[model samples]
Target: MPHGFPIYPWLCLLFTYIRGLNSTVGESRMKSLLLKPRSCSRVLQGHPWVFAGEVQDLLPGSENGKTVVLRDSRKRILGSGVYNQNSKIIWRRYAWNKVPFSMQFIRKSIEKAIQRRPVETCRRLVWSESDLLPGLVVDQYGDALVVQALTLAIDMRLPAIATILQELTNAKAVVFRNDASVRKLEGLETYVGTFNDQVLEPLNLDIDGLSYQLDLLKGQKTGFYLDQREQHALVSTFAKGGAVLDAFCNQGAFALQCAKAGAKSVIGIDSSDTAVQLARYNAKENRLEATFEVENVFDYFTNNRDERFDLIVLDPPPFARSHAQVEGALKGYKEINLRAIKALNPGGILATYTCSQAFSMEVFEDLVSGAASDARRTIQILHHCYQAKDHPILLTMPESAYLHGLILEAD
Candidate 1:
């Protein structure tokens, strides 16, 4: 050989090359995907959420609420998500892109949602994953902002989100109503606190030229039902000069609107003594003469057959919590609607709603039809209402569309 050790070295080099190639192939095949050792393929296949059981293996040292890269079992990148070590939903994917998950992203998402709406006065600025930001919901009531962080990922990102909200909207106050029961499912404790430098008090808002007070710290769902703003206005359009009955009226949202719309009289009923008192206060605040009674709506309607109304509203709370409870919930819905239809005078209007996602549109319609049959009355469906546009729904995820109401004419 011209060069000493050439043949031996060449053989060794070839052997090493073959060994390395084999090793690389094997490693590629065996590489574990996902932040943890679990089934992440489902999420990769199109599901937006990754449950704790689906994690294949946690990256050597991923902390709770850490932003992490998601991958499939083949080590192929899936997307990016925020990891919650203690939660059953281990990851809430924010984007499919590899872009940095920063405060700017949050700000942009909020801004996009707000910009989509024609009216900026009062609206839902962020709707969790519907806005591509999972577990984060932000509602705007005039200058006030109400936020609910439902996941550990969102909980950890709360400060960033708050800063973005303050900067983007110039919100006077940002109230954190993190008291939803869903937090417990995430293994996080419930908390209600305020973020940013803003006052915590009942703030007055102008909705369709009517003044309404919202108690950010003490009210329901950020002190008012902002999602019902459009529906309230719609109800007011047809309420003039009628005797209205608003069952399960919370803070007089519908009842007060009916009164302001020139309803001759309005009677609001709720089981909670506190809600009844608040409804009365709201009526007085609006300078509207309305009656509020603290009584179980079911009991009140079951016993009082002599009373009738030109219009009746049955916007009750959700009765079903899961799919298994849908049947019973339908019964409750039918019962209430039957009573409402029976109480409606000739040519009266019946506005009914079911906030339960478990109650499908078909089932709710069937319930209304059955109730009309039981009441021995003919009803014409005048309008069907859904959750406001600010609460956007993903076409792929039907569960996001929950609130449903119907306006029926009983004759």
Candidate 2:
């Protein structure tokens, strides 16, 4: 080959190297974030999360929990947040206006969250994203508080969080149930322990005259289904002088309430032996005669062809945790609901619920509608119920409205 031809090949290689170098230098100069137009608009509209994919580019040298400036494609500073590259939710936004990521900020946010909630003994103290303390949740069961830190930034600040929580609520004990599966996604290790480094199991919680024993360290979802508090009270309205069935009865919350509401008989069924035992204990502790048995709800419904109830509650755990599980979750929901509809006599009340955010309200309505069709029954929608007041859903964040319920009657 000619010497000039070799020079031409060298020229192409030099050109490509210069372009890559320029691109790297440009990204390195960027301050943590440069969101696409769509992402910037979402932040502008008060949505807190900044997904990892939403970011057009991110600069290095930004540590987790440090204030990172977010900018639009046009390079205008939109807002700032605690950024962590490891999380799918890269930014947990603190404010639209700039704010310091400091102890003072944490204290102010905690104080604001507490003021809105009931200053009573038992309630949700911090509701994660809804209360604007994203990745952090705190619930008060009497004097003890359960804290769950779901993300790396929050998990790293456990000591500070524990100190502030105790100070604000005057909590005698603080238990951390950071053992959720979601923690793995955020690159955090699952942990469970108390601030005082000792868990007081069989913690007594008295709610609306019902005394319940719970193992706070080992119990599900911060030791109880505190979100269902309002539903338990409301379900009792139709339970008076009727036979009631509480399917998927975790700890007998609804079943006990129905018995206390003057139901002739209340039969609660759960597949979990532990839940059944705890529920039976709770029923006895209240001196309420309710039958709780360890039986598969689906099997019981399918086998017991002649049994019918005046009222039935189908409060299942989250049927769909992720988007991919929606199809299977809908099928699961329809199966139980169909069984419930078939077991209900004419004028029977069906208090059905879903805690899956993936299953939208419209979809839940359709699921119930489809169940009614399969059962060949006429149903009337009586009431629309949501999570208790303590777990407030933010307007911008629709996923916070995870719990949806409907009280219906067969005709």
Candidate 3:
């Protein structure tokens, strides 16, 4: 007062108050979702998928591919996630607690995921929800990285992912293999792109002392069946000094492994001509005596019913891509297993696998039992295998355990 200067002028104080009020309103209106009664229980259990039925309300201005807070019916914060109105999975939960989706968090997640697997060779570095980064998968082969962003939020942040991946690993290249059919459910168009260096055709890789060359641009899911590495070796243990048949051999991985293990004869059947060609080339490249044929596996086994093979491997593609396809998928699965059982010599081994997320181990095992009964053969389960160690599964999210296998000896 003595200096004729007011520390807090009336007009200045009014403006400050109004600014604070606007911020509060803006935050509340950013985006928020309320859950129906008992709907937040799944989130409480740490399942990352939030189905549309669980949601009671979406606040105005809730945009697709935007971050939103999830609250229970009691108006208590549960978590936050990337939301999309078009998807049945309204929210792909990224966190269970009130944590900001900041760049620091993203960096730490990517780093931690990379450390989960041995990076000396090809391995899945980031496995979507299993690694706490939902809708994003990154598989590493040497210095090259294959990335798939299944959700728009993750897709939009591909640049960020590429940066973190490249800076951390000094990656020579990053390929976006976004051609998976699952992207359609997220309203995303499929396309392939390389972020840095050009992808080499017939890119060669060494897995368990076996060499495989693949085209990253056109090859199957990240250019190879990396999840079945352990299964390939396990099937080889049964193929030693015996005849081998590998059905739906995408790249002749199993057949080649059997040939390397000194099988009497190895044959690989695949519907894709490109895959057959690749298989033949691999067998030739490694100087292994193995045969590759292009044919529908079901028709081949059904039409050729002679029981001669000592070991048969059925590593089919996903028959049940979605929940609606589960019924038909079960039938298809049973048909193939029955065919293998009927075509096996006495005491022959059958290595069967299903990569469908909808097919649980319980249903798959029951189908196998029914198929064995239909074949009128006595079968004994020898080993049950899962995806390779690199593809870790989340306990709370059973869907993360996508690959299931059972090796059976038949009489």
Q: Write the per-residue lDDT of candidate 1 for residues 12-67, one digit (tens) a residue.
A: 43453344321211212322226454553456456667776676665432355545
Question: After superposing candidate 1, which stretches have Cα over 4 Å from the reference?
Answer: 1-47, 52-63, 68-78, 196-199
Candidate 2 global CA lDDT score: 0.81
Clashes of 3: 0
Model 2 per-residue lDDT tens digits across residues 1-411: 111223453354345334332121222332457887655446767777788888886545346545666777787766657677877788877666555455667777899999998776678888887876778899898889889988665665656777888898888888888789998878666667777455476677788779999887888788889899999999999999999999999899999999999999999999999999999999999999899988899999978968999999999888799999999999999999999999997899999999999977888999999999999999999988899898998888878899999999999
Model 2 is weakest, by summed lDDT over 10 consecutive residues, at: 21-30
**Cα lDDT of all candidates, in order?**
0.76, 0.81, 0.81
Q: Model 1 residue 169 lDDT?
A: 85
RMSD of each: 14.0, 11.9, 10.5
Model 1: lDDT of residue 141: 85
Q: Candidates' TM-scores?
A: 0.83, 0.90, 0.90
lDDT of 1 at 256: 88
